[model samples]
Target: MDQKTNEEMLMFVEKATAGDKEALETVLLSAQDLVFNLSLRMLGTFADAEDAAQDILLKIMTHLSSFQKQSAFSTWVFRIAVNHLKNYKKHMFAQRPLSFEFYGTDIENGKSGEVPDLTQDVEKSLLAEELKLSCTNVMLQCLDAESRCVFVLGTMFKLDSRIAGEILDMTPEAYRQRLSRVRKKMADFLKIYCGEYGGGKCRCEDRVNYAIQSHRLNPKQLDYTEAGEIPLQTMLEVKKAMEETDDFAQNFAFCKPYEAPERTKRFVREFLDSPQLSVIRNAEGRG
Candidate 1:
């Protein structure tokens, strides 16, 4: 997310803190996509991400008045997001262990059945993109939640260590060490399993059949990517640009950043209309 200027943020914050509906709406709109993507990458599922995004937004709204302007508004928002995700990770782990062992085991066992023939070239291309995303998603689960957050913010989102540290409430040195560990872990795994890193037995083409057979990848009902909505040339252009990055974790860059879903917009609208905000408004007015 781009940093908002101090003056612009202060204007929004003042109005929002004073219970200005439009200013509150604008604040939510500005940060919604960034928060959603952060949740998506942290939680590793759309359903969880959506839930987390809504929760984070409400938290932000509820506490808008308490925002101190010592830091960028984006930084404060991300701090809330990172803290929520860390807590969510704990709750998620208590429910079930998240791991990539199953994916690796499936690949080693060669669970791929007969490959299906999808007639359309577009379907084939989209399926390949989906498989690549699926692979990267699994790879992300290998790291613990905090490490994953650091890696995502640093490598994928291109935030510097100092900024990322502020978001995670760690020292820049600590963030760099964590990111380095994650990078090495991801690099080692990619070299062994990812065909993109060369000399890997597992290929997207090989896994596409397995994904299809397992009902994980449905050509008729593509669910993983928004490739269908995006122009082919545009998608290709984005991929080409990502390929040009001078990074060892190039495969990490291939997975598209999560876009906020329609439901999130509805959630934000409903939140704005709810009686909860009225109480805040009354309180602010009395003050």
Candidate 2:
């Protein structure tokens, strides 16, 4: 049944490729689900995903003429999907850190399954949840724009090193090497501040909550400090981008409210619920 569906879907793709509007729309409907999934995983928020999804569809329609069938139809669409998402991440990270999740002090040590000793515990389960949320926000904040982009794209999208590297315009080996550094830096940072989980010594079977990255660490290579580092000279550009983002958010209602909707907000919150997204925040009243 699934195979037959693919055959039918391909026929629609053929027509869409020939510039049939109805066929294009049908093919897009089939493809948009993947686009939405990519957006959700890559962007880590429902609001962001919806916005990215909408933009992708529009780009498909607008650039439909440019899509040469040198690759598979899905591949063409995915290329657009990848580009749109990378742009969105670059925009958001430049603006401000999006909120994440909060687990607890034992986050990175791979002890998530130990089941909280509620009855015999000091803090309630609610505190754990709050900490998880705070932790996620802080992690996002710590990630420089490129690091956040690479980690989310490689991790959530689950793209192979080669493909992920292709999306970022780098060779496969370079991509893996750089990715290793990004992951290592992020994991090391999270452990120190968020209270460590995922032992560097844990084997494949035991390292569950956080997989101890057996891969080599290359922090210096993946470090963006040399590129966009917010130094004394670069402060002006950083401030300008922040100010623009603030202005955009302030007037976001008039621009586009994709990420602000209730449904999307809930989706983002759910995505952030993962222990890894956890971060510490200085929010005063509402968490």
Candidate 3:
């Protein structure tokens, strides 16, 4: 978001903190996509990301009054999201953690022959694209939670080092160094194993059938490919413009923003109408 949008969001925050339910909805809606995309990248699945995004939205609501305008509202939301996700233990990937070594081995040993055509009625190319998106997204899980957050914010979201530092509670210098290291690690892994961006021969198209058979991806119910609200070309243009300084930009370009779950607005409406929200607003008004 640009400075104008941030300023607009802050105005909504002012009204929201003062018990304007409509403004509260506006604030939540504004932050929902950012929170959800961050959660999805960090947690590695739509179901887990959706659950985490809702919880993070609630935290944003409960802490609405405490938002000090020292930084962009989106940055503050990112902080809350990072804090929540770093501590979040119930996500599936959190329970079964991943490491680059394991991921590299999986890529190296993964089945890679032409299997029976599983595309059925769907176009083969579409299935291949879905698998490619899904596979690359799962690759983020190989990083530890902190590194994953840094990669998502620094590379994927293109957050500036200083602002990212503010969100992560680190000095800009430190954040830059961490981001550099994380990028190199991801780049090295991709160079050795990922064919799309590197020399290694792991083609996403070749693995589509194997992925479907193994239940890693479902051709019928594609997740990542189907959830994008932003047009791929537009997002690619934005990413291309934002990511000029890295070799892995193409590797990271696949991390596009997804549409927030439709039920998010419904949840906000329900919360706004609830008695619990009334008590909270009353307390904030008193405070």
Candidate 4:
């Protein structure tokens, strides 16, 4: 199902809110992949994404009683995730923010010296793929948080404008307008700097050595390249829009679904067995 049907969602909320631990676990786990993937794209690294995702999930569970069943549970979860990520201040990219201009300049002038031989453990092509994924993921950091959210929801996630607008508290028209502006801004940047997607000379293979030397990407510990994939259909329930422009789909196609780390489930299990949660449950009359 693209989205949870209303009856199924209400059943989950009722069971979860009434202290059904198994149902609650099911609800939280259902949201984990969507929240983590969004966090990954917004925060620009696996570790930061996982950290932010854990926080967001906690917020969702604690606030479960406040859900009024007015929207799809997935939509409610997404709303919370987006709000948390936009306001999160401790992520690496937030600490050292990037702009398109600065990133483009780095792309043009960043490479130095000889390309290293990274064919020790894995093929050069694998390292190149790692660098390419790293580079594109980092590029989203160039957009401000709000614009990045707009691009991610509108383009990468292919969310319906109406639902996306509701999540961001914007009118559909306004969301679409912002999405259009950011799309052009990003497309222009890619056209000028990305060789694979545009006319620029900067190739992922050409920058692999510099990326590794700068510690931007680690060949020994490739977080994204080593992660498991969740097929597009198994990801968030995005309602495809007919108006979504086709110009940059290929450019951002690297925004595929990556599975959340297995520790998230363990974290949830720990919370369920904690005294802190016991206090919360008793206070909320959920036990």
Q: Best candidate, lDDT-wise? A: 4
In candidate 2, which residue ranges exceed 4 Å CA deviation? 1-10, 19-22, 41-44, 89-93, 97-141, 195-287
Best by TM-score: 4
Q: Which order, best to worst by TM-score? A: 4, 3, 1, 2
Each candidate structure's TM-score, on Cα atoms with residue i matched to residue i, is 0.82, 0.48, 0.89, 0.93
- Residue pairs in clash, model 4: none
Q: What's the C-alpha lDDT at position 203 in model 1? A: 80
User: Lowest-scoring 10 consecutive residues by lDDT in candidate 4?
Assistant: 233-242
**What ranges in model 1 sit over 4 Å off?**
1-6, 89-96, 114-122, 218-221, 227-247, 280-287
Q: Let me know the TM-score candidate 2 reaches against the reference structure.
A: 0.48
Cα lDDT for residue 255, candidate 3: 78
Residue 189 error, candidate 4, Å = 1.1
Candidate 1 residue-wise lDDT at 186: 78
* Residue 21 of model 2, lDDT score: 52
Clashes of 1: 0
Clashes of 3: 0
- Tens-digit lDDT track of model 1 for 147-183: 8898777766666677778888899888888887777
lDDT of prediction 1: 0.70
Cα lDDT of all candidates, in order?
0.70, 0.44, 0.79, 0.81
lDDT of 4 by residue, 129-236 (tens): 888887888999998889999988877678888888999999998888898888888778878898877778788877777887778878788887888987655655
Q: Across residues 13-50, which tens digit of lDDT does each residue of candidate 3 receive?
A: 99988777888888887777778888989998888988
